[model samples]
Target: MTPALPRFPHGPGSRYTARAAFSRTRPNRQVRNINLAPLVQRLTERDQWLAWMLHEHRVLTTQQIARLTFPSIRTAQRRLRILYEYALLDSFRPLVQSGSSPEHYTLGPAGAAFLAAQAGCDTAELGWRPSHTGRIAYSPALGHDLGTNELLTLLAARARTTPAQLPLWLSERSCVRRWGDLVRPDAYAHWCDDGWREMPFFLEYDTGSENVARVEAKLASYAAFTAATGTRPALLFHTRTASREAALRRRLAEPARNLDLHVATASADFTTDTPWGPWWLPLHTPTRRLPLAELASRWPELSPAYRPQASDDADSALGLPVPPLPPSDQASRP
Candidate 1:
């Protein structure tokens, strides 16, 4: 029974033996594959485009990308997922109406790289435009803009009329630091004494649509500003809206009285008088082309009076005590 060739071993002509032989050699025939970095690099480029798109735009949804002119919707969506997988994009899925998807994406590190690489691309270039209003004209650190230039011109002109007018105290645009929750007033001025002293005044440009809550918050901000700098700053609110202007005046008068601080309003027309020492004074901004210089001309007198000292001796520079800031928030000057 053991003889007779093991009963023709399954399939025809010993196919079973042939398969076993091939299986034993198959392990030796295997080839090793390497070089995954190039594949990863190619994937990264796709993610880079998605990142760039997100970095430049605001609150874009998946559906929005499908309709954009640059990339086909499917491609955009696929690429966005790649970016998400790579952590190059940050996504937020807010709760909305039932059946509504609240997914939104923004640029992450990879997106920022794409933004930097694409010359002159920033939050502004991506269509997140800030209105021209509320922009500061000049700060030595933040640099000068039209608003800063205009304000300086007005300040320079006003200094010339006073019998006790001091020289124009000027802090150039570069002197302030820029960062964090800190704010540097648009300009630091003085009744120009040769000391180039700092009369702490913060100029805020408001373009209306700012509500009561905003005003209150800003009042708190003023309180914070004074606390950080150790000086009572005159907040010069500028606005084109008459209603907002009037409301600001009313709000400031009450809170300022409570806090023993001063907040005033002005307009671009230069005709609106700025209040001084609780007395409404008709102020004039000089018409000269070189206003700061004209303001500086009086520097001999003004700088000496308003000059800032590092002595850490004086209690209050503005002659009024600043209200203590709230416990949770601290103000810092930049």
Candidate 2:
């Protein structure tokens, strides 16, 4: 919904090679026409939402789409196959070393056309190019993008069954528009349980490729952000391993304490522990890990610095990204 993750919660994984292959485009795909009425009439609300979501994220694995929007993986696959058939989506499965990866999807020509028409703007304004999917397939950052989206999509999945909701999730692009000068959070978000407490945090999804000093150095900007905004949102570091987490925690403890910043550390295993469990190790209490919701309580004054512009039940007139999950009206459908 917002610009694609400049960086989001993720870790390193398989790299797509120049020699890699992708799922072939369906031979019977429909051609785009100047008139989009027929195309618009044919799509379900879910289908249209998925297309916008793809445009926002640039690409999404089948598993991510399923968890973020559908009732089940089976239903997601069935519906996505139809979208591909009509050229509403374009997909490719990476040629991995062992077992195959879930197919990855990017916004297709028809989808791009539909969204542009809806916004009453040009596709170029949407930042889409004819070679969108092709570029994504060959980019070195493919693994990192998928990994970052994976973290939030998993959180979206868990929130699906519970009362919790993600009120605002700003992509790296949106983060830059708002906080670029002061901080470099890969993404910024507000997680809340309906009518209760909200936890706003700057997400730093690490791949463990940098030196500890490089990681520690980023804290200075976070310190600057706090001083400027008069709001103290938590800064979370999601890295790749226990060892990486340990090294970061040790190095960050002093700087974080000195700045009086609230920093927490976790790793790849967090997805397995389901993010809500006791996986987060705050720099202040490195010895004990606590659940995520508990972190909100640590700062009784925790409120998002800026409220999201979109209402819970309606789209923005100026086109803000929709909720991370689909509309509640579509939540129960197959």
Candidate 3:
């Protein structure tokens, strides 16, 4: 959290107008609890556009903010200019990146005040509602498929067995907050155990393996997370290649020991039981594409010991067959 800016004291003659509002308490250095979901739901596209502007707070490039939000780079740039002219966003430009001209935009003080007020609310009632471009909004539907309630349920369930705390990655600012810029995780999670165990997990959602640079960068990021959190989190990768997985872990292990991670594949050296059932499971399945809602409905039937004949193939439905690991790696990795 950044230090609170100085506030002017109320003068004896100062009087509030109908449109003006005043804060009763001084701003705390710590983040005051607020319901972000309702705040986000109260916003519209215009609000998002404006909020994105404030994210940089007068220092981000237009191109950068666009890339962060819109579908395409060109579209992001175009819309950004429009927002600026309409007084919704502020921009400054002709800067350099690797020696090229670029435009930067950010939220003005007016925008900042607006967001701060919204941020000040009851923590218990507020929740995170993420936007389509992956920003936290204030609404019931924080993100697309996984609404706020659904997320709470799934997170609560994961909390039961996973021995690590679950920290949220609501924004880049959050990364800066917990770990500082020099050392921070992709997301922060501190297990809410008796001792309040804190572990920062590195999350990588891979769609395909084309971006070598990105993968390498994330590995470096994990290094930072480990240094800041004082413990290595379970490296969680959604879907990735065996070779890629091995190489990344190998690189990560050099810097940090006591590392524990989970990568789901069709075959592995370990057979673990889950809420789903007890069986040797692949990280990725070949055919079980059941939607999560359907899975929730039929969750009663699935136990650690339960396995369906349909899931008989060790390579169930993740597209690849479970390949037997060579005796060496299997024994090493759990």
Candidate 4:
């Protein structure tokens, strides 16, 4: 008998989900039908919040989770192991050329059910299926996704130690839902210091994988957005290295100049420097690297831009991209 091909859900044939069908090489099991109601009751607010994050971002590494939510790496590992055994989360470790990769986590069946039950919605409405973790385990964008999450997680980590706050952070899906036709940013975020002085911006995390010209061309959409909305939000680029940053600045300068787009850039040192420090170099002031706080000061007009939540939009204002930071004890309570 001719063998039948396995099917996939959520229409993952798109490039975002490069591997269309189920991975024949799933490294971890997504256990199902566990008696998790009691376990869910015992789950901490942070644990619930972590599951919510996985549902939103698709995946996160142990290091990223520890930095974002837990006080210590050991502590994170201990709790994460418990969650995995309870089927509240599923995880996988991708093969690497050198050292082993950190365990990456995604919402498991129990976690999805818990979230759906909490929200009074069906599991299908939560946008998850039995094949969810299988698909992510082999995704080509795994590294890129991790990089994007790491950057924002770092910001959230810094926010914890400082007086700054990450009030609003949106994933690429949320960005698309909000501004798909006009622009496609990898992520969207706003950073605020002690005074609550804020700057909202779109992030384009570059891996030096595509043409510089192609990256530059995205400016046109931002220009179109400004034309349509009569509001301009800052567009920031974070690339892998100094050379890539230089190439982008050169190609982007003229279009940005011609279109009057608000663009700033930071390079590899982004991870080392206090992200709030003077690492960002706005195109207008190329010679001077300004602190993020000072940069916000430079553009006094760069305030939070209101988004149009069309009735057709699926996300409730409170859902999808919750706050960049974890939900508080009060907010996480059922």
Candidate 5:
């Protein structure tokens, strides 16, 4: 027979400690404390946008959401905690050995219901089921998806401070829905600055988990897409390492030789620098690193799509002011 474990003696005033211990032991049950009604009432349009983005992208880390939506990490943490408590958001921290991983968030049930009500449709019609969202949060591709969003988050943050223009951003889901059959870029963006005229590009964010040959094969699809559409958008490949970049460049040399497409490569090592800075090197000229704005000069024959028209109503929906175009001379530079 095993000896009984000794129980610590509790003083007469230790009832509060016992209750606190019970609460700690049953944290998952704390959802009962959330008041959903008032929480919904407290949500603003910006908050709603955060929910929509979560629904669209599936998952976003605390830092990514902070960069995309909030002015600071502290503010994001406080607000996200309230949202999480009220069931408007759900979060999980991936296991790491040393430092704690940042909390990653997905849309919670209450947020789905709120969005459905706003759309005048059933929650099912909003393409949101909490179970499904939860599963995706734990997917193997979670890191890749977050990395792709990180690129856009960086762009959004830059737009807040710099004169660089990110006129349009389309997520992978949006791309697949729109062009699923042809080629689905990880993300699509348009960059225009005083130095670089206008560049509409397809972003392929590689985590180095994929085979290099498989990655290089994507150029053929992009080439076929250009042929069909008669419009060739520059292809920007952001890889995780210099070795992968070299391999991709070698694989791309022959296939891209005769295609009308323009390819540029950049490594994730330069993420701390301005994403639009001189981090990108053309596949044809690997030695030269060009800022995004100066890339257009290299391909004079390729005509970029016109910038998408944005109205006052659209600007209001985006929650950002559209920067005025630079002077004609500055914008018209080669």
Candidate 6:
């Protein structure tokens, strides 16, 4: 008799074998030729806005861009493909062990030139040095930056549906320009709603990579910022784990003398729900997670200097409907 065939424990159809087979046979699409002139001519104001955002933020994934700029994911993907093909945006896929990572995009040379002309400045002045951007694209801090951006992108998406508007999203670079000596927040945001006026905030995104002592040191800097400006914006710390949140809270509880500041901490998992919802646990009151709107109530002592101005032009620029303002103190929270 012929030698018995080697025994197969789970036959030849195990899940692992099937996955390997599928991976080997997976289809890869070829890049399609695109007409440059027509694509450039078809670019709309919104498209330009997207490019400007990329230039400012350095890099954003397709999902983040979709949430921030487009009405729907499908529309975003279609438009992004066109933009990519026409060389208005450059993208790269990071190496991952499992499923592919979302393509992260940066402003292309042509797009940068267009923005430079629009701003009446040179590309270097607009911070569009290709080499520098490329370096940033692959930097180790990229994940931290992306995490910070995702928080803002979620707010932008909410603005499209709710009666809220994120009128201003200042990048870290912009923050440095404004207050580099005092502190550099991951990002600064101004939120406005029917009830709430422009409420400015400083976002500190923590990925649990830094030591707790370092985080506390940063808090000291924010405290210094509050003392100088006399306008203490809420410091929102988005940490990577519950343990990190606990550790941060402990450090926050024992702040330096004469350093009274408002701070809130939340884990990264909270992003699964509405980012502006009751996700933030204020250090002053660690028992409950308060919504973004209610954060002001937690710090009644803070007299914010930044005020939201009434402007039809601003509303139009954001493409949001102007809601009737309720009769309430512009500076006071109800």
* TM-scores of all candidate predictions against the true structure: 0.33, 0.86, 0.31, 0.83, 0.78, 0.77
Q: What CA RMSD would candidate 2 show?
A: 5.3
Clash counts for all predictions: 30, 1, 30, 0, 1, 0
> Which is the leading candidate under TM-score?
2
Candidate 1 regions exceeding 4 Å error are 1-144, 157-182, 191-200, 269-334
lDDT of 3: 0.33
TM-score of 3: 0.31
Query: Candidate 2 on 1-334: residue-level lDDT in tens?
Result: 1122233333343344422244555664333453567776789877887887787777788889988777788998999888877778887665555676688988987888888777777778777777777778666667777767787777777777777777566667667767788886777777765445778888898887678899899999988988898988888899877888888888999999999888888898664638666788888965678777678877676656556643722442114655677776336532
Note the residue pairs that clash in candidate 5. 196-293
TM-score-based ranking, best first?
Answer: 2, 4, 5, 6, 1, 3
Q: On residues 1-334, what C-alpha lDDT tens digit does candidate 1 reach at each position?
A: 1111222232122211111010011112101122223334654433443443343222345654443322356776676666555434545443222454423555544344334434444434433322111111011111122234344433433333332232233322222422125544444444332223333345555544346557656666556655665655445566544566666776666665565455545544443333222221112232322222223342222212134345523542222111111111112201
Comparing 1 with 6 on lDDT, the higher-scoring candidate is 6
Q: What Cα-based lDDT does every candidate model obtain?
A: 0.38, 0.74, 0.33, 0.74, 0.68, 0.66
Candidate 6: 10-residue stretch with minimal lDDT:
14-23
lDDT order, best first, reads: 4, 2, 5, 6, 1, 3
lDDT of 6 by residue, 177-271 (tens): 66899998898887665575456689988877778888888877888888788787878888877887888888877783347777788886775
- Give model 2's clash tally: 1
Task: Tell how far residue 295 is off in model 5, in angstroms.
Answer: 1.6
Q: Model 6 TM-score?
A: 0.77
RMSD to the native, candidate 5? 11.0
Write candidate 3's Cα lDDT for 1-334 as tens digits.
2222222132211111011111122222222342334444444554454453344222344443433334466876766655444333444332112354344344532334335454453222222111111221111111111221122223333433344223232222344543455543333222232233232234343323235455545556555554554554444443223455445544444333332222222111121112112221223221443222232222222211111244443341211111111122223332
Name the candidate, 1 or 4, with the larger lDDT value.
4
Lowest summed lDDT window (length 10), candidate 2: 1-10
